[model samples]
Target: MKNTVCLIAAASFLCSCGGITERPIGVIYTNAADPIAATASGGSRTGTAEATSYLGLVAVGDSSIEAAKKNGGITSVSSVDTHRKNILGVVTTYTTTVKGN
Candidate 1:
C-alpha cells in the first residue's frame, strides 16, 4: 500500500503541469517557444514579459501581452508568442512576447 501511494504521488508530481498534451512536455526538461497568434503584417518592434513558478507552489512574474508591450514600448500588437521552460516539474518559466510598432 505504501508503494502504491508513492507511485501515485510520483505520477501526479510528474504530470503536474497538465500541459503535456498541448505540447510534448519532457519529464526532465521542457523548453519551447511557440507562436500563439497569427499576424497579417510583421511588427517593427518587439517586447517580452516573463513569469516563473517554483515547484508549482510559488509563482511570480507578469507574462501578459500588455506587460510585454509596455516593456517593449510597443503600441499596437501585431503578433503574440509564448516561450515555456520547465525542469523536472520543479521550476517553470513562462514568457510572453508581443510584436508591434
Candidate 2:
C-alpha cells in the first residue's frame, strides 16, 4: 500500500508539471496597408475578445473585427494581437485584441 501511494504521488506531481502557460505569441496582420492611411480615415478604436474553458480545449473566436465594426465608422483593422494562457492543462484562456481606425 505504501509503494502504491508513493507511485501515485509521483505520477500526480509529474502530471501537474504538464500545465499550460500564457504568452504573447506575436502580432498577425491580415493585409498590408499604410499605417497612417489605416488609422486616419475613421479615427482609432480597439476591440477585444476573450474565451475560457475548463477541463477541455477551448477555441477562441476572433471577435475583434466584429467588435470594431459594431462601433461604427471603422474603416479598417490595423493589427491583431493574441495572448494564450493555460492552467495545469485543465483550464485555458485566449485573448484577442484588434486595433484600427
Candidate 3:
C-alpha cells in the first residue's frame, strides 16, 4: 500500500503543472524635458486586462491596450506587463497591465 501511494503521488506530481508567468512587452522612459512623454516619475497608475480561452482553440477574447487604458483611466503609459495563469495547460487567463501617470 505504501509503494502504491508513493507511485500515485509521483505520477500526480509529474502530471500536474500550474503557475504564474509574467512578461514585459514594452517600456517607456519618462523625460522631464517632454511634458507629453510618459514619465517614470509620477503618480503610479495601473491598468489590467484579462483574456480567456479554452484548449488553445476556441477563444472568446484577448487583452488589449485599449482595455487597459480604460481600466487604468490614463492616456499614456511608461511600461507594460503581461501575466498568464494556466491550469493543466488547458484553461488560461491572460492578463495585461500598464503603469504610468
Candidate 4:
C-alpha cells in the first residue's frame, strides 16, 4: 500500500510539471491600413479607412528562447485577440513557442 501511494504521488507530480504556465517575454503592437487604394485607367482613388491596432503579449519558456536565438531571430508568431480591457489597445494575451535550426 505505501509503495502504491508513493508511485501515485510521483506520477501526479510529473503530470503537473507539464501543465501550462504563462511567462511574458515581450509585447508588440501592429498598425495596418484598411481599404486598399484602387486604380483605374482614368484615375486612381484612395479612401481613408479607420486604423486598427493590436497589442500582443509574447511568452515562451526560457529554454525555448535560448534555442530560438541560435536559429537567428523570431521566425513566426501566432496570436489571438481576447478583446480584454487594458491600458494597451484591444489587449490580448499570446502564447508562443520557438523553433530552432
Candidate 5:
C-alpha cells in the first residue's frame, strides 16, 4: 500500500513538472475600402480580407488568454475595415519559449 501511494505521488510530481502551458500567438489587422472606393483600391480589399482571415483564427475570452497574460506574454489589439463597410477589432497575446541548442 505504501509503495502504491509513493508511486502515485511521484507520478503526479513528474506530470506537473512536465506540463507545458498554452500561450498566446499574436494579433492581426486588416483594412478595407469604402464601397465606392473598393473598386479603385484592390489593395485595401485584400488587406481587409487578410485581416478577417487572421481574426477568424483567434479564440477570444479563452482561458489561454488569461494564462498567457499571467506568464508575461505580449498582447496586441487591432482593428480592421471590411469592404462591406464593416469594422472588426481583436486582441491577441503571445508567449514565447526557447529551446536549448
Candidate 6:
C-alpha cells in the first residue's frame, strides 16, 4: 500500500499537459515563437489569430490558419508561425501567424 501510494504521487507530479517537443525552460514565464511552414512566394502581408487559457480551465479563441488568413486578407499563404506564452501556467496564450500576399 505504501509503494502504491508513492507511485501514484510520483505519477501525478510527473505528468504534464503540454505539446512541446522538448522540455520547457520557463516555469514562471515563457514567450516564444516557432516557425511552422514556408513557401517560395515572398510574403508581404501578415495576420495573427490568438487563443487564451485561464488556469487551464477555460480556453477560448480561434488560433487557426484560416482565421489568420481571413484576418490578414491573405489569399496565398507563404509562411506560418506559432507563438506561445505561459505565465506560471495560470494564464496562457497561443497565436497563429500567417503571412501571404
Per-residue lDDT of candidate 6, residues 1-101 (tens digit):
99999999776555553334463535568888888999888888999999999998999999999999999999999999998899988999999999999
Each candidate structure's TM-score, on Cα atoms with residue i matched to residue i, is 0.77, 0.45, 0.55, 0.19, 0.19, 0.78
Q: Give the higher-TM-score candidate: 5 or 6.
A: 6
Which pairs of residues clash in candidate 3, taking residues 3 or more apart in a chain or in different chains?
30-39
RMSD of 6: 3.3
Worst 10 residues of 3 by lDDT: 25-34
> Which sections of candidate 3 miss by over 4 Å?
1-39
Each candidate's lDDT (Cα)?
Answer: 0.88, 0.52, 0.61, 0.31, 0.30, 0.88
Candidate 2 minimal-lDDT segment of 10 residues: 25-34
lDDT tens digits by residue: candidate 4, 3-101: 999999887654523343332211233222122122232212111111122433443232233343333353332211111122333553222223222
Clashing pairs in 4: none
TM-score of 2: 0.45
TM-score, predicted candidate 4 vs. hidden true structure: 0.19
Q: Residues 1-101, candidate 3, lDDT per residue (tens digit)?
A: 99999998876555422222132211121111112234566547888787887776866765886788778986768777666565644676677776776
Order the candidates by lDDT, highest first.
1, 6, 3, 2, 4, 5
**Residue 52 lDDT in candidate 6:** 99
The per-residue C-alpha lDDT of model 1 at residue 96 equals 96
Per-residue lDDT of candidate 2, residues 48-76 (tens digit):
66667666656545435465345444457
Runs in model 4 deviating more than 4 A are 16-101
